[model samples]
Target: MTDPQVEPAPTRALPLVIAPPRGRQKPPRHLADLSAEERAAAAAELGEPAFRVKQVAHHYFGRLERDPANMTDLPAKNRDAIASALLPKLLDPVRTMEADQGTTRKTLWRLFDGALVESVLMRYPERATICVSSQAGCAMACPFCATGQGGLQRNMSTAEIIDQVVDGASAMANGLVPGGPGRLSNVVFMGMGEPMANYKAVIGAIRRMVAPAPDGLGMSARNITLSTVGLVPRIKQLTDEGIPVTLAVSLHAPDDELRDELVPINTHFKVAETVEAAWEYAKKSKRRVSIEYAMMRDINDQAWRADLLGDVLNAYGDWNWVHVNLIPLNPTDSGPMLNGQVFTRSRSDDMREFVRRLEAKGISTTIRDTRGDEINAACGQLAATE
Candidate 1:
């Protein structure tokens, strides 16, 4: 059963910790960051009735209304004051690019402080999905990502993160997009930063996305996915949150040697530890953890590597709940470096062979469709570049 011609896989040793950037920048306060009681108290302090808080919440969350003038149910004179006191403009669209017959639109947003973050909305026959950024840029120095090249700017506030979704929903509601009026059915936190790194705001955004009308967008929790580059402690903490949103682990390699180089953070928490954390999340949430593997040329695309990966995942013994999503690395704006290159797209034959090897071992696998490639909207391509 052994392929003697192929070289043996290298031994994966636990790597030493590579310290991450210290001192995170805090974002400004917004209404979405407040709890329900706090919102009511704020309204009361503003001389508006306590019931007005729920009314305004309905306008923003349930109705997807952004303009204060459009809330005709409120007093015309008091509408602006109430909205100004509670809701503040967060994201201003700088540029929006459309591709794939205009079904995929990517927006470059300028925050209040002029920091840029990007979000993409794609429409399908039955569903429309919006990819929202949790931070202005990324702290994870994944060599293949354009976002990581610039380093982290700061973590986005709860309202800033939720505004991306509200904007997409508003676009769909007003028929601004090509595919007629439709609701946003899915939200994925895979745009610019690692969701797990911005734990508080990201969790708050999830709660708002899942809570019913007037309190949240009322989207189903199951439709939202939070991806991380394997932050072990946060992965365990998320299990107790009880939201049950799908957790996607960006595990590019099964072995630690290559992973430590590609995902520098891996040096801190090795491959086995990361996988175990993911399994714990799966057990608590009862949601299958998606293993995201980006295929590159001869680097990590060998058939033998696929077998090794399968063996690693099989070690967890929950073969039924874990799925492998193979992503063909998108060519980033950043060129190849001695450490690694973002432009190294894997060959088709090698990718197929890798998938075949995994399937042969009884592990479920799928190749992700690289949507919005023309507009640089694929995975790891959100660098806020024009």
Candidate 2:
């Protein structure tokens, strides 16, 4: 079959070497950032009745309402003031592009300080999932990721992270997309940042997502998945938090030699140590850990590598406690440029063989369906360009 005719993604010239951002803009306080007690205290500080906090929380989290006018539970005079103070605008939509008949939407957001981040909302027949960023850029300088090329600007506040979910939920609730009014079912921290790097704020955001309404969005903890690039210590810390959100480790390569080049942090935490940490989390949390491997043609997609990956994972735990998600790498700016990124995508047969090899080893694996590639849907591509 011939490939569909589509325009090539415009390359935005960027520094090959990533650099730390010099300055950042501070976003205003958001209600999601506060605890139940903190929200009430904040309301009191604004000279509003304590009950006002619940009313606002109900509007934002419960009803997916963000506009002050829709928050009629609060007095007309105080609604605007309270909403403005507690729920200040944190993410400004710079651009929105939709694919898959408008069921898949990718949004480019500009934070208060002019820093750029991207999120994706994908609606299916049975579920709607949103991928949100936890940081402005990214600190993990993975050579094959657009965000890694940009480097870290700053860590996003809890409210900023939660606000992305609220936006996705709001979009689903209002029938703005192809699917009529729906509820967001899944949230993934698989966008620009390394979620574990922003540990505290990301945890706070997760709490706000799973906490009962008036405190959080009230989504099931199981529906949330946090992806990390093998942050060994942080993974152990998360096990103690008692939140059962699925942990996804981006283990691009199974061996230290390749992993050190693919995921630079491997230099600090070797592959064996990282997988061991994930196994510990799975043992304690009783949740199946997801191992994410992005398949690149001839780079890490060799059949022997697949067997090695299975052996490495098998050494830690059984199949029930772990699963592998093999992603056919998207053509991004950071992808190999010798003959353009066309060579970056692993062939279907190669991916299938890779999955078969893993499953044959009594390990479970699945190939991830690529989405939004036409619009440069891979994390930082839009932000880096637009």
Clashing pairs in 1: none
Worst 10 residues of 1 by lDDT: 1-10
- Model 2, 301-367: lDDT tens digits are 9899999999998897554889998887776443334224333767889999999999999888988
lDDT of 2 at 158: 97
For every candidate, C-alpha RMSD to the true structure in Å: 6.0, 3.9
* True lDDT of residue 116, candidate 2: 94
- Candidate 2 lDDT for residue 61: 88
For 295-320, candidate 1 gives per-residue lDDT tens digits of: 77667778988999999888886447
Using TM-score, give the best candidate's number. 2
| CA error at residue 13 for candidate 1, angstroms | 23
lDDT (0 to 1) per candidate:
0.79, 0.83
- TM-score of structure candidate 2: 0.92
